[model samples]
Target: MSSKTLISVVGPTAIGKTRLAIILAKHFKTEIVSADSRQFFKEMHIGTAVPSAEELKAVPHHFIQHKSIFEPYSVGDFEKEAIAQIEKLFQNNDYVVMVGGSGLYVDAVVNGLDEFPQIDSKLRDSLNQKLEKEGLECLQEELLVLDPKYYHLVDIHNPHRVIRALEVCLTAKKPYSSFLNQKRKKRNFNSFYVGIQADREVIYERINQRVDIMIEAGLLDEAKKLYPHKNLNALQTVGYKELLEYFDKNFTLDFAISEIKKNTRRFAKRQLTWLRKNKNILWVDFNTEPKVILEKITNQLKTNPHA
Candidate 1:
């Protein structure tokens, strides 16, 4: 590993991670690499809570709104791109910032993905076929039967995730979760993790307010424009998916908004569950000042230097 550090700021949605990351980037005079999966799409802006224009102009940012909804992007793809971007950034700076609430994408950059045996294309096609015909809930049920552990952990609402796990389970003749938490790849730079946290109630309320703000900012109109391609994997996001249901006449507008809040809270809970497993994270309260957090980070790095 080199003397460079990747300062990864992680927390649940609406937890002020972006603000903290910007502060760190400004302090270190480095760029930011975003790991927020939904924020990658150019079409998703308001609902994804993308940084405001002023904030984007504050520091150089990579990977945000860099992909189209029509394009297919995966965690593996992001991992490669992000590591490369950080490498480029580290040539001039000692520290780089990576910030997002997407746990899998963040972990992909920091620890590398767990290896799994490749399943046959035919098996995957069959699984997708099952999904289209049987609906997401059917495959979700089967996954619960095949690998209850992954079923509980994965976003069961996502068809891609559901089919991926099912194919793995069938081919490996074992639970998909069994393939996870394996050995990780080494990186060239040191990683220093920081997390923002708050009481569950406070976090939930913040999410609710954020969703309302999105709605006020014309998220419903944005979702309506994308409704024609609601089945696209990129559209399977928390804010857009609920509105898609409304457009499909399966949900009322009010109920859809409520579901967005409910689903976002669930996503935040899952994020916390994933982040808590990492013991190296320097956690701070959501209300904590950025300078205070920076002091804590400096103190830790004194003992655990990036070099």
Candidate 2:
């Protein structure tokens, strides 16, 4: 490998990214910089499948459980911090591994993020009033009208996404689509993009089983502890938000669990869709034997040693 090569392993949740990243890091004798957004919060453990204790012991990790739930973290923040961390790691390690399921976070590290304009507090207050008075559905509709393209790509159920899109569209009198043209910013180091893939049935089965495991591991209790903060924009995630509905008596535990699996499946599909658009990704099907997959990556690294 060239000096300070960066390897990224990205995929849908439960596609074995954690295990594969650990193995790759061990093989390269390097450490990991996590791009998983949820795994960054110290209070959120079970819900976010953070590397198990043993895996963390096996390979050094950065950015895991490094923040409080209340902290205001953004993809831009992650981009800046992760780049700085990777620069430091490059001083010692040749190959730095980045692993996560969050497509936006990974993109932030690999490709520099856009420079969004400063938030207008008045516009935000008006949007917040609309959210409280007419509900997120109103903001969702507005976003769809203003930028149908982004509306289709964004998490439709996320109120924050809806509000932000509306804020830009209303204030700028333009589609949010204009700002998301995906211009690739230059990076200091070469990056090899690795993605994990599996059969759809296998992936869905794993997602369901993983949800069951999360519930058994006290995901409900964790949700209960953070129930008061559920309204926070950061807490509007798949596992916790579904459980918040259960706590509100809007759904049973069984139904909430079902919703979690369903939402996660849709999320996985979206993740794959996002990754497929990037031509740089080298896909490794997890269904194949580990030896075979490792050989593929090893061969690629040998052929293109610069990355």
Candidate 3:
């Protein structure tokens, strides 16, 4: 059998990754396995920026809205499931498309996740208590001091991710990043990364526009329904958290919307930081035509055919 390739379409949020991935999937006559962590829950539609129904109909997509917000779906679970799906896909197609803005999730599927020593249950419970009492800022500060490297790389706003890293650091007595990139699991397929690029100003403008669109599409109502479950790890993301604050009377609606835009911009910056570190990705302008990018991928596959 010929080797299979996993073509990863990755970029910051609101950078047109979904459109490009769809076009590429159609071109290759294959399905897409999403790596976007936020889009995993069935309850989060508008806030997570899930692909439109029409877009989803354009290509068969797996792993989108496949789980519930109440369920515990870790990156390890995603890595296992995504590889299983890709293995099935490779039986029919030589190339399979994987697209999303979640850098860690994407890396989990491509390179395999790092292993960490088991943490003491008391430490985890203590950290959870600290989170509830002192707020996420306190945990962020602690992580900054404990593992500055991972702090810079991680989504500091996500309490689950921040606490997870801290737990690993405290238990292993080493920086959380020290465990990363230690060893990669061998897979049956090769992976190639395609990153969408844009100027900082343009990216921020697009994010603001997307936030406006989300609000106009009744994101407030969607978030309100999930307000009771705000404490869930899945709801700890940027969009829902900001709007939940509005519902809690913590901020005015306008202010909450503004915060969403600002935080999204910061999230985009962190995404770019993570993606830029990968020297192997073929970067393309956000406005570049899909066919042009497809041609680039074809050339790459020609040069490195073996998976």
In terms of lDDT, the best-performing candidate is 3
Question: Measured by TM-score, how close is model 1 to the native structure?
Answer: 0.97
Q: Write the per-residue lDDT of candidate 1 for residues 173-211, one digit (tens) a residue.
A: 999999887887889999999999999999999999999
lDDT per model vs. reference: 0.91, 0.86, 0.93
Clash-forming residue pairs, model 3: none
Model 2 sits at a Cα RMSD from the real structure of: 1.8
Q: Give the TM-score of candidate 2.
A: 0.94
For each of the candidates, the C-alpha root-mean-square deviation to the true structure, in angstroms, is 1.3, 1.8, 1.2
Better of 1 and 2 by lDDT: 1
Query: For candidate 3, what is the lDDT?
Result: 0.93
Scanning candidate 2 in windows of ten residues, the lowest lDDT window is 110-119
Model 3 residue runs over 4 Å out of place are none
Off by over 4 Å in 2: 305-307
